[model samples]
Each structure stands twice: as C-alpha cells, then as structure tokens.
Target: MVLTLTTFLLTLLSIPLLQKLYTLFYNAFLHPLRTFPGPPYVWTDWYKCYNDVYLNRNWTDVLKELHEKYGDVVRVGANELHFSNPSVYNDLYSPTHRWDKDGALYRVFNQDESSFGYLTYREAKARKDILAPLFSHRATCEMQGIVKKHLDRMCEALGKREESSDMLFALRSFSLDCITTYCFAKDVHASSAEDFKHPLVEAMDAAVPAIRVLQYFNPWRKLVFGLPPWLAKLTDPNAGARVELQDMLLEQVKEFVEDPKRMEQTSNPTIYHRLLDPSNGPVPSLKSLHDEAMSLFFGGAESSGNVSMLGTWYILQNPSIESRLREELREAWPDLEDMPRLEDLEKLPYLTAVIKESLRLSPSVPVPLPRVVPPQGATLSNHPIPGGTIVGMSLRFVHQSEEIFPDPQTFNPDRWLGPDASSLNKWLVAFSKGPTNCIGQNLAMCELYMAFAALFRRFELVLDGTRSEDLTYSEGFLPFFNPRHMRAFCRPVEA
Candidate 1:
C-alpha cells in the first residue's frame, strides 16, 4: 500500500516533466516554426506563461530587444512571430487578409461574444453590422452632450479636491460614468461621487490583476465566473463586484423591455434600444446584452481613461506644451464662457497633435494583438510564415519603432503636425486599423478632444511628485500603471 501511494505521487510529478519534455522537443525540433529566429525558450509555452502571467514583464520592452537582436520578425511563442515593421499592419489586419483573432488567448478574457471576442468572421460581421450605427460618426457627434456632462463634472470634482488626486482613478471614474451613461441610457453619476470611488469603477480596477491569472490558466474561468454568489464571494476576489456590475446592467435591460417606448421617451436611450428594436430584428439574449454592455463598460472606461490620465501627465510635464495647447484652445474658442463644440476642437491641429502623441507614447492597449495566420500562410517583413501559426505586433513596440518615427520614445506633437501626420496615421494602431479595430474609437476621440480642450483650457495641471517612470507601464493585456504613484494636482487657471 505504501509502495502504491509512492508510485502514484511519482507518476503525478513525472507527468508534467514528460509533458514539458514533449513540448520542448516538439517546438524546438518538430514544430513548423522551428526555423523562426527567437530565444531558445521561445519554443516553450512555459516562457510565455511565466513572463505574461507570473512575472508580468513588459512585452513591449521584451519584444523590442528581441526584434532589434533578431531583426524585424522574431518568434515570441512556440507558434508565434512578433512583427515590428509598420508596413505590415494592413497586410495582417485588412479585411482581405484571412487572419483571425487567436481564439485560445482571447477566450480567457470572456468578452461574451462582444465585438472583441468574436472568433468567427460571420458572427463578428453580423454583430458589427447590427451595432455599427451606434458608433457611426453621426452617432458619436450626437453623444457629445453625454461626454461633456461627465467632463464638466470631472473638472468640477477636481476643483473641489484640496489635495493631490490620483488622476488614474479620477479619469477612470469619469470614463466609467460616460460609458455607463451610454450603455444603460442614463448616467449613474459615478463621476460625481465625492471621492470618485464608484463601486463599478472599483470593481473594474480590481478585476485587472485577476485577468492575468485567468488569462494564463483559463480552463478555470467558466468555473470561477460561473460561481454562485456565496461561493464567488468567498473564492473570488472580484466576484462580488462583478455580480453587482452585471446586476446593474441587467436591470437596464429589464427597464428597456418593460417600457419599449422608453427608448423614444428617454433623452438618451440605452444601447439596448437599437439592439432591442423590432426594426433591428431579433433582440439579443439576456446574457449577450449583459455581456455586450459589460464589455463596452470595461473597454470604454479603460481605453479612454488611460489616454486621458497619461496624456494629462505628459502635458503637465511640459510647460510649453500646456501654453501652446491653451493658446490653440483660446484661438479655436475665443469666448471661454461659450462651450466649445466637438467639431471646433477636432479642427485644432496642435491639440490634435498632443492627443496623437500621447496615444503613440502610451497606448491603452499596448500588448501584442495576436492574430492567427490563415491556413494558406502568408509573408511578413518578406519572410514566409507558415499557416496555422500565430503572428502579432505589440502596439508599444510598433509605435516605438525608431525606424518608423524618429526618436520614437520621445513625446513630440510636431511629428503629427504637418502633412506628415497623414502618413503617421497609417502606423497609429492605438485604435488599431481595419474592421476588427476598436468600435468605440470615434467616441473615444471625441472624449479626448473635449476633455483636453476643457481641462487644459480651464486648469493648470502639475504632477504632484509623480515621475515619468511612475506612469511607465508594465504591460498586461492593457498597460498597467502603478496606481499608487499616478497622482496629479490641479489648479483652476486664473482668469
């Protein structure tokens, strides 16, 4: 009996060793990517799992060094190649390309069939087709009032704060309010909270660290996310928050269903209106509706808020930039008392340049967006990549390519100021490019422009003991700022 128990324990230990041996042998000698140039451990999944999930190393830095050493194309995983060339953006992401989202990697995020998680071409196309109108240029324009209200509240709240405030939390709270307003059809006043620590905002922030854990070992995602309330509260750190957020959103769906005419009656009808409209065909399932709303809330809040907070820090660091931006705003909107229109802000070249540079320097989604190579295979940077392999480019690495943008690490708005700015747009993958790119981009842009215009025009921002490296990110799926050090102090600009 003792021998039998000892044998079982030995077998358990040997299984993983045997599996690792098989993986290493297969990836190094037998895999189709065997010829790809990369670090020895790139052939092993353990390398990726350790760095991305365990250590949370900056892939942007990791991939950049690998590419510089091995040339533009470097193998990052057993079947993955990281491309640094800007010219291949279209080839990889354009609709003509057969490349699709890496199902295995993205599934862990559980986007719930939202646009980001759509694995199949047909499903994504159908969903995008349905929701496209809401994010159209016209729709974004129409939503300016909602965005402006929150921006106003953020500025007001900042003015009220006596001490330095964590801009990351402040901006994230504001963005959550904006997105929740759009999603639920009414503002929850999250930004107006005296301390700017809304429950949903707190929940979303709490969920980020857990994402890395689940993303690496995602077979447990269903079990954990599907946990009963009581069990989830005990086992999952974010489960309570997640439940609360979902319940809030689900209630909005209930509100829409009970009063169909509320879509017309409400000043700002929820996202559910268009989705649930009889003219739009079948209403989405409760889970899909909940999932879609939750996805938007997370995406919208994180992406735009990161841009706003980080951009604010960069602007504050440069007095000349602050002066020039304010001068541009004043020129564009001569009467400070009169609210500036979104169209007017969009036309300001210097302000536009500042926003563009900020995004380039610190894109919210800075990680490698992995897309699977088609079965037919393809060439990237003149190298023939085998089919069924994973290929991607880290936006952080791509945006920082010294070849594409001279002194790429430096934040210079002038790079986006001239006729050259048009060329720069091709490489600006912050919103990504092509059909699979961010759907909320137009709204995000509008928010950025308005927020920058209002904040810079109205207040003078100073970094309250925060260094550039304080905001220097360690990459997760999105850039992660050390929240403790992301503080900024604001003073209202004297008349």
Candidate 2:
C-alpha cells in the first residue's frame, strides 16, 4: 500500500510539467503570435529572445533586420512586436491610447514606494503637471547664468588637463553639478575627480546599473528588496550605492523641511521649491522629491554629456565641418570671452544645424522607448496589430533611414543648413516628438550651444592617433563611446 501511494504521488508531480510542455508546444504552433514571422524559438522561450538581444549588442539593429526579413511588423518575442513603420509612433505613445505601462523595469529603478521614480502613470502625470513649469523656456532662461557659470568652470578644468581627457566625463561632472545645485540648493560639485569621489555620487552610479539588472528578474524582486541591507549590498552593489545616495539626499531634504525660511529666500525658482508647497499643488512626499531630483540630475547630466562628446567627435573628425562651425561662431560672436547669450545662440542657423546633425548621427538615448499596445488594438502602417503587444520604434534605424536622410552615413551638417534645412528638420526626431518628448530639452540645448561655442572658440581639436571610423562604441544602458580609448589632441587657438 505504501509503495502504491508513493508511485501515485510521483505521477501527480509529473502532470504539471507535462502540461507546461504541451502548452509551450501549442503556443509555438497555434498561438496568435505564431502566425507572425520571427525567429522560430521566439515563441517557445524567453531566454532565446534575450540571447538574440545580447548577441546583437544593440537589439534595435536586430529588430530592423527582422523587419526587413519578415515585414514592417514582426513578432520579435512571445508577446512583443517590432514595428518599423512611422505610424507605430501614434499608436504606441498617443494620449488617446488606453494602453498601460507594460514594462515592469521601472519598479526595479524605484528607490522606495514614496519616490517619484517608481510612481505609476497616473502619479507620473500628476508630478509632470506640477513640475512642468520649472523646466519651461522662461525657467531655463532664468537659470542661464547658473548654467554658464558651471560651463565656464568646466572649460577652466579642461584647460588645466595635462593629458587629453574625455570631454564626456568632464561634461558629465558639469551637468551633474549644475542640476544638483538647482535641485538641492546645495552644490554637489561633481565636476572634478575630488567632487566625484564623494560617497553620494559613487553610490548613485553603482546603484543605477544594478536596478536595471534587477528589473529583468521580476519574480524575486520583492525578496531581493527584503534582504538585509548588507546582504542586498552583496547581491547588488547598486543597492549599497543607492543607500548612500539616498541618505545624502534625504539629509538635504530634511534640512530644507526644517527651515521653511530657507526655502522662501530663493529668488530663482526650482523644481524642489515648487513641489514643497501643498497649497501650490499636489506635492510628492519629501522622499519622492529627492528621488526625482536625483533622477533628473543623473538623466540630464549623462545624456547631455554623451551628446556633447559625440558632437565634438564628429566635428573633429571632419575638419571642414569644424572650420565651418568656427567661422559661424566668429560671425555670431567676435569676442570669445563675450559668451553668446541664449538668444544669440538661437539665431545661429549653422550652429543649430550642427546640433541637429550630431543628434541624428548619435542620439544619446538610442534604445527603443518601449510601450505596450492598448486593449482596443491599433493599426500600424495599415496593418492591424492585436492588443497587449509590446511595441516601439528604433530611433537608431529611423534616423538612419536613407529615404529620410540621403547619404545617411556621411556626416553632413549642411543637410540641416542651406535651403533644404526646414525639410530636413521635419524628419528630425532625436529628442522624440509629441507629449512624451524630453522636458529638459531647452536646458540641454543651452549647454550644448554654450559648450560648443566655448570649446571651438578656444581650441582646435584633432583626433589623437585614432581614426574616426575605427573608434568603437561601448554598450551601457546608455550608449557611451569609450572615452579614454579615443583621444583628441587639442591645440590652443589664438583669439
């Protein structure tokens, strides 16, 4: 009787495993996604899909290749669809769409429940509404002096460098210091190695990549979070780094909260002050304020810095383009010390074209902005797409399309200048378009124009023993070129 009971229990245990296998087979052959063309294993295994993404180094390129093979719309994963058609933009990011955020990746990035970084769509929208004014044109204009001071300091720092340092690293520090000062009313001074050595900066950097990885293994995230802080540190260095960063931010917020008079004394408006007033509007918890501030600081800094580096790289590689840019700068501003005001930079047509061209060639955020399809379903390029599908447009592919940008490989800023400039501008979607566009664009542009104007005016940059075509890109959550590996020889130019 005992033997019979044991055998029966073992048989029962095998049933679920068999059922799972059967379901997998059924999905592979009979599911709706099965009808769509993709790699054969995409339907059967998630790991295989991830492997393809990793192997390709850039999943966007893989998506483009698949689209070419299968059609404009291809089932790239079990539930994910890749759309190459421009109309995909409308269906995915449109305000009217009922689709909710499907990617749980944000959850891993969240510092705590009270932080804005973790907040759902409803919360994010509410926060955006309250905070939008702070990043406005008027707001950015008010902050121009603050921006310029930091830029000037950065230029000084670069001038002092004995060896050719990565412009991205220097700019990253500058942007970080600038944003932190605005947000916290205290200078983090991330512009120098000594400043970056501060515990807070080190921790935040470590935590960011950790959170990205943790988001992938969603099943055990809560358990991961629940681990002792020390144990968590062992598992994810980011968690430890995050703890230090958060502690620093919290301390600053506490100081502000304790001294209401201190908050009132600000002549210049900041996002922190705007969010602190309950009657002014719905305010996120102080904790949320801190996280959001950090997010803005890091996001704004890293992206703007990378773009500056890439833009500089492209200009240096093409000497004619560099010379033309300098001529425009000279015409725009005769005196190098007399920095071009924000308004002055705006009127420089060639400079604007150079910025646009650089963004097209190397967007800082090249990854697809992933969005889920709504329940009502949608049409992409006249083809009906089912609801609940994951969809995104690859900016890397879209910007490089030969139809939109003729001779796409060539670095031609004039395509954005001259008579055809307006037509070319219409096709430019580097910062993205519509409601979801980058809020910090004005600030980024201000820094870009200022940096370019300052650097080119003062120094002539040349590639240091490295060919432009031979420079390799390093893959991160953001695409940053290997800065140290690629060097530039800078010769001081006579004013």
Candidate 3:
C-alpha cells in the first residue's frame, strides 16, 4: 500500500514536469509566435505574477527592460505579446481594430457586466452607450458645482494647516468626496476633515495591496469574499469598507427605486439620476447597477487622486515648473478671489501643458491594457498576430520610449508646448484610447485642473526633504505611491 501511494504521488508530481516540457517545446517551435524573439523561456506568465503580485515590482519597468532587450515586439508569455511601437499602439487600440478586451486577463478585476469588465464587443458597446453620455462635456459642465464644492472645501482645509501637510491624504479626500458625490447625492466629506484620513479613504487604501493579490489569483477571491462578515473582517479588515461602499451605493439605488420622482427632487442630482430614470431604454438589474456604481466610483476616485498626488510631487521637484505654472495661473485669474471657469482653465496653454505632461510621465493607470485579436486576425507593427492571441501595449513603453518622446523620463511641460504638440498627442495614451478608453476622463481632467489651480494659485509650496522616497512605487493595478512621499509645506502667498 505504501509503495502504491508513493507511485501515485510521484505520478502527480511528474504531470507538472511533463506539462512544462510540452509548453516549452510548443512555445519554442510549434506556436504561432515561434519566430518571435523573447527572453529565455521560463514560464513568462508565472514570472510576471511573481514580480507583480509577490515582489511588488513595477510592471512598467519590467516591460521597458524586455522591450530594450528584445526590440519593439517581444513574446512576453506563452500566448501573450508586448509591443512598444507607438504607431502599432495606435493601430491595435484604434476603434477600427477588431481586437476585443482579453477575457482571461480582465476577469481578475471581478467586475461582471460592468462596462470595464465586459468581454464581448457588442455588450460592451451597448453598455458604453448607456453610460457614455453621463460623462460627456455637457454633463461635466453641469456637474462642475459638485466639483467646486469639494475643491473649495479642500483649499479651505489646507489653508488652515500650520504644518507641512500630507498631500496624498488631502488629494485622496478631494477625489473620494468628488466621486461619492457624483455617484449619489450624498457627500462623504472626505475633504472636510482636518487630518485628511477619512475612514473610507483609509479602508480603500488598506484594501488595495490585498486586492492586487486577488487580481492575479482570482479563484481565491471566491473563498475570501464568501467568508461570513465577521470572519472576513478578521481575514481582511478592510473588506468591511469595500462592502460598505457597495452597500451605500445600493442604499442610494433603493431610494431611487422606492420613489422615482426623488431623483429630480434631490439637492444634488447625481449620475444615478440618469441611470435609474424610467425613460432610459433599459435599466440595468440591481446587481448590475451596483457593479456599475462601484466601477465608476473607483474609476472616478483613484485615478484622479493619484494624478493630483503624483503631479504635485513632480511639479514641486522642479522650481521652474512651479514658477511657470503659477505665472500661468495668476495671469489667468488675477484676483485670488475670482475662480476661473473650467473652460477658461482649459484655455491656459501652460497649465494644459503641465497637466498633459504629468499624465504622460506618471499615468494613473501604469499597466498594460490587454486586448485579444479577433477571429479574422490582424498585424501589429507588421508582425502578424493570429486570432485569439492576447496582445497589449504598456503605456509606459509608448510614453517613455526615446523613439516617441525625447527625454521621456524627464518631466518637461515645454515638450507639450509649440507646433509639435499636436503630433505629440498621438502618442499620449495615458487615459488610453479608442472605444474602451477611460469613461471618466473628462471629469478627471476637470478635477485635476481645478485642484492644481485652486491649490497652487493660493499657496507657495515646497516639498518636505525627508520624504524623497515617496516618489518610489510598487505595482498595483494603479501606481501606489508611498503615502509619506507627497508631504509639502504651504504658505498663503502675500497678495
């Protein structure tokens, strides 16, 4: 019996070895990507998971090194390919392309039926039409009041601080408040806090590190999410906050359902007003509504928060950047009491350049946006990619490539200034491109411009010297900066 058991265990162990040998042989000589060059074959997918999930290595840096070693196109995994060519990026991500969002890769996000996680082009397009109008220019203009209220609160709080303040917390508060207000008429008041550490913000920050783990190993999520509330809190204390966010969203939805007329009667009619309206073609199911709300809430909050935080850090690093930006802000709004309209802010060439340059240098979403080739097949950068193959372009590759932007790593808003600026727009995929690009981009831009103009125009700022490592990051779905990195001392400029 002991000898038989040993044989069975050995056979099970040998199965994986045989599978590895098969994969290597197939990838090297029999796969469609057989001719493509890559690093020594060692299970690229597991290597990626180790670096991204375990070591917390920056994926942008990892892909950048691979591109440097293997040229513009490199086979990064058994069935996955990475391209660094900007024109090819335009081709693959363009609306004209047939590439669909990669199902296997996107499944990790755990957002089902939500636009961000939609796998089929038809369903995604249908959903996009329903949600896209809410983020249009007109909608953003209408929503400006909610944005301003939060921005004003943030500036008011920051102005009262006597010591160097942590901009990460403050910026996150502003973003969290803006998004929650947008989702429901209720405001989280994250920005109104003196300490800037709102409970929801703290919970969201705590959950991020663990969420990245579930993103790679998704099956375990079922186990984690299935635990009873009390036990789940013990396992992932922040899990309660995540549930609370969804619960709040559902509660708001319930209000709309209970009294449909209340949508128009509310003090702040939010995105939910349009989504839950009966005149709308078809209302999403209750779970779908929650999924959509949660997706938009995170999208609206985290991306803008990161931009506000990282942009401030970089702008302060260079004295000239601060000088030029402040000059532009002061010129645009001479009286500190007079706030510039969002449209007027858009017209400030230097301010626009600074925002664009910041988005390029440290994009909020700094990871690869993967897409699957269609059954008809297509070629990227002249390399024929067979249908069903997973392919993506890392924004870091396009943004940081010396081939596309000279001195790409260095932050210079001036690069975006002048006749070449229009041409440079082609390579700017910070908010991504084509049909599946970020839905909240217009609103995010408004938040960024408003925050920068409001804060910098009123205060002269300098970074706290001891917090240099704050600029360093570890790879999550979004760039997670060391919270301590963005501390800055501010003084009200003598008008």
TM-score of each: 0.92, 0.87, 0.93
User: 71-174 in candidate 1: lDDT tens per residue?
Assistant: 87888888888887877776778767646788766787777577777776666667777878888888888888898888889989988888887788788888
Give the alpha carbon lDDT tens digit for every residue of 1-495 in model 3.
999999999999999999988877787779887678877762345667776777777777788888888899988777888898877878878987646787656776567768887887777777777777778878888888889899988888888888888788888889888878876777889877767877777777776666567776778866875677677668765677777776788887877777888788777766677677667668878777777787787777777777777778778888989888998898888998778989999999888988888788776777778888888788788888898778888787778878768988788888988778898988888788888888889889999899989878988887777455657776667766676657777777756
Pick by TM-score: 1 or 2, better one: 1
All-Cα superposition RMSD per candidate: 2.8, 3.3, 2.6
Candidate 1's C-alpha runs over 4 A off are: 1-23, 236-239, 254-262
Q: For each candidate, what is the lDDT?
A: 0.78, 0.68, 0.79
lDDT of 2 by residue, 220-330 (tens): 667865577678678765567555555677776776677756777764666667677776676566767776766676667666766777788888877888988999898
Locate the minimum summed-lDDT window of 10 residues in model 2.
Answer: 111-120
Q: Alpha carbon lDDT of residue 194, candidate 2?
A: 45
Candidate 3: segments with Cα more than 4 A from true spot:
1-25, 42-44
Candidate 2 residue pairs in backbone clash:
203-241, 207-238
- Which residue pairs does candidate 3 place in steric collision? 470-485
What is the Cα-based lDDT of residue 418 in candidate 3? Answer: 75
